[model samples]
Target chain A: MKKLINQPEQIIDEMLDGIVSASPSSVRRLEDTTVLVRKDAPVDGKVALISGGGSGHEPAHAGYIGKGMLDGAVSGEVFTSPTPDQVLEAIKATDSGSGVLLVIKNYSGDVMNFDMAAELAEAEGIETAQVIVRDDIAVDDPENRRGVAGTIYVHKIAGAKAETGASLEEVQATAQKVIDNARTMGVALSPCIMPTSGEPGFELADDEIELGIGIHGEAGIEKRKQMTADEIAAELVERLLPEVDLADQDEVAVMVNGMGATPEMELHVFNRKVQDLLQEKGVKVYDTIVGNFMTSLEMAGCSLTLLKLDDELKELLDAPSHAAAFKK
Target chain B: MQLTVEDTIQWLKQFNDRLSEQKDYLSQLDRAIGDGDHGINMARGFQQVAEGLDGDFDEVSDVLKKTATTVMSKVGGASGPLYGTAFLKMSMECKGKDVDAAVLADMVEAALGGIKQRGKSEEGEKTMIDVWAPVLGTLQEEDFDAERLKQTAEEAMQKTEDMTATKGRASYFKEKSQGHLDPGAVSSYYLFAELADVIGKGA
Candidate 1:
């Protein structure tokens, strides 16, 4: 209820305006739609990489729209998936001779809208490929899994592949590889307030936390009394490690992502435990990122993403890129 | 009694008014088990449908197609596509014709099929399908009429309070999703109930 904004309905538009103004050199918002495309879009002869979801997860779909990340990002209302027409405009704006690849998260709305967009694009004679990221380890049901922080890995690797003049099939396949190998788990200390509703999604007592929380403030698998940072890290890592099948000497990239309101000091403290836990298991840590790469609007929490690395993935992850949110 | 294009437009207008009035109630329901945006999303979608309805249309199908497009463009949530697809399918069933009771039943069935196909959900999932499926059954009965369909939809919407969610964000709540009315089912009930009211009044 107490936030800096003129009106609730104008938030997405005002935010998109600010994004374009702040990053004029890298991105531009499409006229009359919730799409942000690369400044020099439809990059000749390169497969375009596009991903998006609701608007609250800023510095995600839009911030990654730059040199070697997403070519276009479509945004919906807060915690709402973009409609098919908005997504189709993004596809049309970013599609070059090489086909476009859609990197979608596994939420029901995102999946259905993006699939509908792909169908629309195909009807217009544009080749399109898609990869659905469902890497959240918190949900046991694979059929109903929610994609979390690991989606950034998909954007990075697939964007790198697309920047190298790879075909749509190659980019989609590489994105699928990242989705297959990566796992993510999140914990929320408190729930976030939706701007329009002016009420928190859920309330937790001072002594409690929710484990396996989704990015959209959906309830997690379990709620229990709060644990220490090390205990939380252990629980999250224990749940993630089994799914990725990390072996001895296997190189992995780790990301300790803050959920908007989490501070860097706490994230690093959590990262320290994650590193120690990975080392204890004989998993080689190739690289580490700790920050708010993806966030639920001002929610007090963090998620950990681990991408099992091979030579191809390592190279792609290390490839030089200049996105507003990510740089390497 | 055959339903005309005017009746379809009136149904939409009435649904819009009802949604605007019940927006907070729907959001309250969603806040219990899902992210509390169903009411806001539905209100925004119908506002767009109202704006799009300004143009003249020849038949109920044309009105429905316009509503579908406007809702799909303006409503940016799961309900947007779900309701949009339902309207789109219903439009296909009503192409170039007025809808009598039999045709209305067929259109409702098509709308239910479209929701099932788009959401990849089944009956008993505590979704809008829970209301639409039973209404479809009622519409197929021998004495089917506007009053019967309205009664059946209201009962089904009320029944969702006792069911456990198995699809969409509500499913994430597991057992906690019970004892709360499904927001989507409530909105869908408003849609059908408004349609019946408009038709019964000879709009």
Candidate 2:
């Protein structure tokens, strides 16, 4: 309840205003909407990429809106999906002659609204393609999985592909490839508070933690007594490995993402454990990113995302780009 | 008895009032198993719907189409699309036609069908479908009455308290989702109850 803000209802507008002011060179806010588009949008012949979700997950759909990343991001309220019209506006704003690709997360609202936007855009004689990211391994059913931190990989790889003048089909296919090879799992040490309600969505005992929580402050798959950082890392890694089908000597890129409130020091300590565990399994680590790339509005937790890499993915990962959150 | 366009507007006004009164109660229910935004989202959507109801409407479909677009634009949550789809489908069914008991039944069916298709959810998954599906069945009965339909929706909404969620964010909680009323179902019940009240009085 005690956070820095003016009014609960104006959070999205105020935050977006601040973002455009701070990064005027890279991004601009679309008039009368909660959408941020690249300054040089509607690029002559490149396929545009758009992604967005609720507002609390800062530096996600918006922060990635720059060179070699998303061309536009349509933000919703905290923990809420953007309306179809808002997403459609983003598509229209960012669509160039080539086409547009929507990188949608796997939550029900997000999937439905983005799909609706694509349909709306198509009706208006614009070409549109969509790729839904459902990389969270915690949910067993592919149809019901939630997209987590691994979504950033899709942004990077697919954005890199789109920047290279790849066709919309090529960008979508590459994004799907990332979705197919990537897996993520998260553990939450505390629940998040919604600004409008001014109440924590759930309660966690001082000695307890929740495993496999989504970014929305929903309770996780399991609640148990807290474990050491190493133990938690091992548990999350083991849970992700089988789902991703990693074999000996295979290479993978790792992203240890903080859930807003987790400190960088804790994330690095946790990342070290994950690297050690993968090394123990004879897996080669191509690169490791330990930071708060995606967050859950000051919730205390971390998620580990592993993308099994091919030569194509590695090159895209290394491609130079200028986004506020990720560069190169 | 047939429902006039005026009745349709009244139904929406009543639903908006109900949501305004029960917003906090519904949000409290969501706080237990979901993201705790259902009540706020629905209230915001209905408030916009009320504000946008200034145009002349020839039939119930016109009113419903306006409601659908306004809710879909203003409400930024799962309920927005779900309810928007429901109203959109209902409008498609009721377009340029008078709505009697039989047409009302068809509208309910279409709304329920739209939610199922849009959400990819089923009747027992502890969503708004829990309230909507039973109401659809009641609407199809030979002796269908507004009071009976209202009672059936209320019962179905209450029944969601004992069910574990299998869809949406609540599903993440697994067994812990039980013993809490599904917030979407509760809001849906208010919608149907308000509709029935308006229809019964009009009759």
Candidate 3:
């Protein structure tokens, strides 16, 4: 209620306008759609990498649209799914003669809408392939699960493949590989307030936290008396490391993502513990990213994502990229 | 004859009152399985709906449309959009008529369609639809009574405790959403029952 806004209805639109203005000139917002793309996108023969979801998790789908990450991103209103039309526009806007690869999260609405968009895109002669990221070990659906924080890895890896002039099929295959090897888990200490309503989605006592929560304001798997950051990290890593195919000789890209409200200090503190746990498991950590990559508005929490790397995946992940939120 | 603006305001005021009456219960249900803001969110939305009413409208449906738009714009979160879209669809269906039982019934059906389209929810997903689907079934029957509608809606809301939520945040529970009513669905059912009362007996 005490936020700066001319009107509540205009919040999403206004925010999009601001992002467009502040973003690199290469990044352009497609006409009347919530999709953002590179100005010189679809450079002749490279496969186009596209990703998107609800809007509140800013610096996500949009900010990641740049040189080495996403070729385009479709955005919905806060925590809402973008219509298939919006996603289709993004597909068209970014597709050159080459095909496009869609990196979708596993949420039902997101999956349905993105799939519809892909079908529409393919109908229009734009070859499209899709890879769903369901790396959140927090949920039990092993094969067809909701995409969580591990989506960041897919974005990075696919972006690299596309930048290297990989075919759409190749890029799609790489993204699926990343998805197959990754696992993630999250915990929330406090709920976040949506900017328009100025009300928290849920309430937690000062001494409690929810485990195995989804990104939306939904309830978590369990709520228990609060534990230290180290304990929280241990439990999260325990859940994540088991599902990921990390072996003794495997190199991995580990991401520690903050769930909107948690501060930088906490992320690093949590990262330290995560590093310790991985070391103990003899999992060779090739790369580490600790920041607020994907968020749930202002929810105070974090999720850990681990991607087991083959030589090719590690190279793609290490490819140089420029996006607002990610730096390689 | 169509309803006056005053009648519209009265309905919203009563609706807010109904939300307040069930606020604690809704919050209690939410506390058990999901976020505990359903009661407060519903109350806040209806309160905003009440505040938005002013002057006379030519059609009862227009008033309903305004109410729907008001809640959609003012309320945030899933409840704001879903409930708001439902009412908006219902209002679109009710254009220019006096508030009659059949029209109300049609409005309910329209609202359900809007929810189904927006939420992509099925019958047993343990969302607001669980409460709504049953209530609509009862309302559509010849044996439907105002009291029976109210009672059945509450019963359906309670029945959510037995089903596992397969949508939204509660779905993460996998099976833990069982034994707890969805707070949003419970309040939605209450709102429906209250609207049924206002429309059913012509009180």
Candidate 4:
């Protein structure tokens, strides 16, 4: 209710306009669709990399569209998946016969919509491949895991691979490799309010926190008493480290991600324990990124993502990139 | 006995109105175990469908196809593609044909089939499939009873309250998902119930 928007239904449109306005030189919106593409798109012979989901996760699918990130990103309504036609438009607008690689999150809506779009794109003679990122380790079943902040890692690596003039298959393979090696676990102190509904996504008492939450504010695995920054960081790091094999002191690129409304100070506090805990367990931190790379509107929380890195992933991670939300 | 373009528009309009009225109810049902946007999504999609219905259309399939695209483009959720595919399949089945009771049954069957393939789901998953599957049988009957169709859809939707979901995000809840109505099933019930209303009016 306290949002500074004219109307709830216009949030996506207005936000898209604002993003394009801020970075007109880098990104552009596909006409009449909820899609943002790199300003110099269809980069001739390169395979196009497109990734996106709901709109609340800013600096995400759109903000990462530039030279070595994403060729395009389709936005959905708040916490909703982008529809098939919108995705198809992105594919058509950004592909240059090298084919396209769609970096899809492992949610039902995202899977179905992108799958349908791929089918439609293929019917129009556009070759496409997709990698489903199921990096959230909070779920008991691996197949049911939700893609969270770690999806950005896939974008970086895959987009870099594409920029290398790699074939669609090669880009897709690298993207899938990132997906297989990444894991994320999140905790939420407060729920997000959907602008249209003006309703909280979920409820949590002041003394409680929900662990293993998805970016859409879906209820996490369990609710427990709110803990100190160290305890929360310990819980996330412990759960994440076991998923990726670092038993031999393997190196990992760490991302201590804020879930919106959580300031940099708190994330750094959380990352402090994350660093110590990994060091104690003989896991080498290859690199670290701590910020709100992906968010859930104004939800107050944070997640820890671990990307078990090898020589290839590390090189790709360090590659040059430019976008509204990323530069390296 | 066969549906005309006029009749199809009436049917869709009725579906849109019902969804518009029950939007909050469907979302409330979803909040229990799912992301809690079903009512809002369906209502928004159908409102667009209703607005777009003013165009010139010569066949039922044309209207259905347009509605499919509108709902698919506007809904922007799991239900968007699911319902969009359902209508698209139904439109494909009814294309260039008179959609009588038997043909309507086939259309519903085709829609159900599309939903299954699109969602990677099946009956008894506590989804809209539960309602669509049973209602197909009633549509195929020689009697073609409107009341019976509505009752079957309502009963099927009610059955979801006691079952655990094994498909889509609801499946993530496992046992905890039981005792809550599947939001998709409830919205689908409104869809069929409105179809029955259109039939009863002999539109």
Candidate 5:
């Protein structure tokens, strides 16, 4: 309740307006939809990369739109899936002559809505393809794993491909490759408050933490007595390593993401353990990104995303990108 | 006899009223295990549905579909989509027709299936499943009578008081969730009981 805002009802809309106001000249909002597209969209025949989901995971879909990332992003209400019409609006707004590639997270509603939108877009004579990012190894079902933080990588590589004038097929192919190689796992110490209610959705005692939590403050896979930073990182990496073949490889682009309430110092402390653990496992991490990339409103905790990389993924990852949340 | 749109709206109104009546009890159940907002959120959504009631729909499907959209927009968390999709599926099954006991049965089956598919929770996993499974089992075994369905659903919801939750936030309690009824099951039971009462009164 001690946050800065006029009213909870207008938070998303107001924040979006603020984002557009501050946004670079390269991005513009699609009419009558909450989608933000590249200023000169369609790039006149370049394949477009579009990704979106709920709005709370900010600087995600919208912030990633730029030269080497997404061509556009459709945003829904906070923690709510974008409507099919909203997504279709984005597709139509960004469709130039080349087809569009949609990078969707592996959540049920997101998949279904995007699927319906893709069908509608196809009906409108637009070619649309999708790559679902299910990089969260924390979820038990490989077939049904919820898409966690690894979606950021999809935006990066696919955006690079589209920016370089790759065909729609080629862009989707590259995104799928990243999906197959990357893995993420998260832990939360507390639940986030829905802005409207201003009451925490779920509660945890001071001495416990939930591992493998979702972004919307859904219950995690397990809860254990709170432990040290190193131990938490070890537990997270233990679950994450099994998804990708890290035994023979060394290079990685590590993202130690703080789940909102966690501070940068704590993230770095967590990162140190991650570095040590990878080094011990003979995994050579060539690049590291440790910060808040995706968050659960104001939940306290962090997640680790390891992208086991080859030369190609590493290059695309290191490529320059600009967004409200990310600039490098 | 087929159920009319007036009956459906009356059922929704009664559902909202009953939810308000049992809000404190349901919130207590949720307090013991899950987030203590099942009654509050359910009541909020149904209240919106009640407000959105513009006379009556031409068909029960139209009524359910409008309720679905209202729930989706008004409710948050898994309930919004789970309940919304359930109603959407139910409406699809009963489109363009009045709802008889058999139609009600089919709609329930479709809604249950939609909840299972969407939430992916299993029977023993303590969720709304704790109440839904028993009520569904009872409904499927017995012929659909409004009075009979009300009695059976009430009994099933009461049974949740002795059961342990295995899914959602309540699952974390492991054994503590035992002896406390699941709030989700309680809210669902109220919805069904209200529907039955409305239908019976109209009939």
Candidate 6:
């Protein structure tokens, strides 16, 4: 309710303008639409990478747009999927002769809207491919899991593959590989308030936390009494490591992502436990990222992502990225 | 009675008024199980439909087409495309054709089919299909009573209170989705109930 903004409706427009202004040399907002593309868009003969969803998951979809990451990202209303028209404009602005690859998170609205946009783009003779990321491990039904922080890993690896002049199909296949190998789990200590609604999505007792929370303010798979940082990290990592495809040889990249309001101090504490747990399980840790890669609007929590890596993935993950919010 | 374009506009205008008046209430229902945007999205989409209806339309199908595209473009959620596709299929089913009871039945059936295709859903999924399917059944019956139509929609909407949602954002809640009305069903009730009133007055 106490968000720093003028009007609820203008939040997206103002936010987009702020982003463009902050990084004018790197990005530009497509005119009259909620789409942001890299300044040198169409990057001439490279397969384009695009991803987007609701507005509150900051430094995602958009912040991931730059040199070796997303070519463009669309913004929907707060917690709402972007309309097909907005997505269509992004496809048009970013698709070069090499075609475009849409990296979509697995939410119903995002899937439907992006699917419609891809169809429209195809109708206009732009070859488009799509990869859906559904790496959240909270939901009991594997078919219905939401994509969480693991999506950025998709954007990173897929963008690297595309930068190598890979075909749209190749980029999409690589993105799918990341999707198949990565899994994430998150726990929220509190709920986030949408600007328009001015009300928290849910309320938790002071002593409680939500496990398996989605990026949106929706409730997680289960609620439990709040536990220590180590306990929470163990709970999240235990759920995630088993979901990875690491067989005999176990090397993985870890992302300890904050849910907007969580700070580095707490995230590192959680990260330490994640590493301890992974090491205890005899898993080789290649590289680790600890920061707010994806976030709900000011929600207090953190998500842990484990991406089981092979040589191809390791190489792609090591590729340099100049994406504004990407830490590397 | 042949439903004229004016009557269709009047029917929609009434529904729009209902949506504008109850936008917050509908959103309240959505807040419980879904993302709490159904009412706001529906109100925004129908407002454009209301504006789209202010001008001249050559046929009822044309009016339906305007509503479809406007809602599809303006409404940004699953409801937008679902409602937009439903109206579009209804319009296509009755192009240049008289809307007698049988034709109306066909239009509703087409709308239902479009909802299913676009949402990849079926009845008992706690979606708008739960209301639309039974309403179509009532329309196809020999005795097409308007009161029964309204009651059917009301009861259908009410029945969703106990149904576990298997689709849309509500599906994430699983069994917790029960005890709350599906916001789509509530809005679809307003849609059908308004049509029932127009038909009752032989509009």
The CA lDDT of each predicted structure is 0.90, 0.91, 0.77, 0.90, 0.77, 0.89
Model 4 chain B: which ten-residue window has the lowest total lDDT?
B166-175
Q: For candidate 5, give the lDDT of residue A166.
A: 81
> Each prediction's TM-score against the native?
0.98, 0.98, 0.74, 0.98, 0.82, 0.97
DockQ of every candidate: 0.75, 0.79, 0.14, 0.75, 0.17, 0.65
Candidate 4's error at A63, in angstroms?
A: 0.8
lDDT of 4 by residue, A186-245 (tens): 999998888877888788998999988888877887899989999998888878877987
Compared with the true structure, what per-residue lDDT tens digits does model 4 show for residues B1-203? 65789888998898988998999888878777888888988999999999999999988999999999998888978999999999999999999988888989999999999999998988999999999999998898887888899999999999999998888778767788999999999999999998888887883
Tens digit of per-residue lDDT, candidate 5, span B26-119? 7556655654556656776788988998864678899999998888655544466667777888889999866776777777788888888767
- For candidate 3, the per-residue lDDT at A195 reads 58
lDDT of 2 by residue, B66-151 (tens): 99999899887888999999999999998988998889889989999999999999999999999999998998888758899899
How far is A121's C-alpha from truth in model 4 (Å)?
A: 1.2
Which pairs clash in the backbone of model 2?
none
Candidate number with greatest DockQ: 2
Quote model 5's TM-score.
0.82
- Model 4 lDDT vs. the true structure? 0.90
Q: What are the per-model C-alpha RMSD values against the true structure?
A: 1.2, 1.2, 5.9, 1.3, 4.1, 1.4
Q: How does model 3 fare in lDDT?
A: 0.77
Each candidate's number of clashing pairs is 0, 0, 1, 0, 4, 0
TM-score of chain B of each: 0.97, 0.98, 0.88, 0.97, 0.92, 0.98
Which residue runs does candidate 4 get wrong by more than 4 Å?
A247-249
Please tell me what DockQ candidate 5 reaches: 0.17
Candidate 1 per-residue lDDT over residues B1-203, each given as its tens digit = 67888888989999999999999999889888888889999999898787678789989999999999888877767788899998999999989767877887899899999899999999999999999999889877876578887998999999999999988889878788999999999999999899889877883
Q: What's model 3's lDDT at A161?
A: 90
* Residue A223 accuracy (lDDT) in model 6: 90
- Superposed by TM-score, candidate 6 places the C-alpha of residue B197 at a distance from the truth, in angstroms, of 2.1
